[model samples]
Target: MPAARTRRARAARKRQRRMAGVEHDLSADEWAGLQEAWGGCAYCGASGAALQKDCVLPISRGGRYTVLNVVPACASCNASKCNDEVTGWLRRKRLDERAFLTRLAEVHAGL
Candidate 1:
């Protein structure tokens, strides 16, 4: 368990380093607005759970924590989506790829 925890911590640090020097313009108000707009996990539509700030493109893949790149996601979806491209991960999970894309575009437009 300790080793697992250490490994996870190391991976998180690496991700942080990868994110260094990248844009991080998502604000608190923007996060609130995003949650309100989505009303749940943006991918799975699961409401009433604490949402996480998930990058549409993972940080490891050069995605920043910017407004257009971030979305509200449930813990499960966030964990499952670790380091994967959004569309392919959604497809693999049997999620509505087109719908997510459309909604994402709408949300970004509204922002």
Candidate 2:
């Protein structure tokens, strides 16, 4: 049988594919970075006690369900960031855009 963590990671990937577009198919390894960010919101460093997968770029703006775009989030961060430009939203929240971008770049690079 597959391990529980493996199963969750797979589920996350499936969700990503669904988010990208119904016709778009994807695999788990695409966002393996999510496993590393499992415990907290990649945005505010908030505990992802209830983790949310947020797209860095809005799907409306053509964000794909790819590792480079998705990041772990807490419920609040995800809700507040909904559909806004990431940098603009982060600035409105008084969050550090540079740091978040740096972290995201690292995650993308690792992939």
Candidate 3:
């Protein structure tokens, strides 16, 4: 049983690594879209000088280069949100997501 468990663990690790390919750095347009989507930081609602670009899908999770998966977030919020998906992260922050998604669609549609 112990050996079987070890094999299963190894297999799980292998599967994760295989699925976790690298993601490219966000592009100019993608960054623009993200800034527009967040209208500032998605977490704390900060805008101006310290605003930063964040990856919606983490590179460690094989996030592809897509505009739909990035957003602007302040440094503090970015650190807090980290690699979590937008919906999950925002829900944890108790943010209203309806408007965000609507804007996201508009931004992506134009791209």
lDDT (C-alpha, whole model) for all candidates = 0.93, 0.75, 0.70
The TM-scores, one per candidate, come to: 0.91, 0.70, 0.62
Tens digits of per-residue lDDT for model 1, 1-111? 999999999988987778776879999998999999999999999999999999998888888888889999999999999889999999999999999999999998887
Q: After superposition, how far is residue 57 of candidate 1 from its true place, in Å?
A: 0.9
| Local accuracy of candidate 2 as per-residue lDDT tens digits, 15-77 | 677565733333576544475744478878976277766788877577765666778888899
TM-score of 3: 0.62
Query: At residue 68, what lDDT does model 1 achieve?
Result: 86
lDDT of 1: 0.93
Off by over 4 Å in 1: 1-6
- Top candidate when judged by TM-score against the true structure: 1
Which residue pairs in model 1 clash with each other?
A: none
Q: What would the TM-score be for candidate 1 when compared with the true structure?
A: 0.91
Candidate 1 worst ten-residue window by lDDT? 14-23
Q: Between the candidate structures 1 and 3, which one is better when assessed by lDDT?
A: 1
Clashing pairs in 3: none
How much lDDT does candidate 3 score? 0.70
In every candidate, how many clashes are there? 0, 0, 0
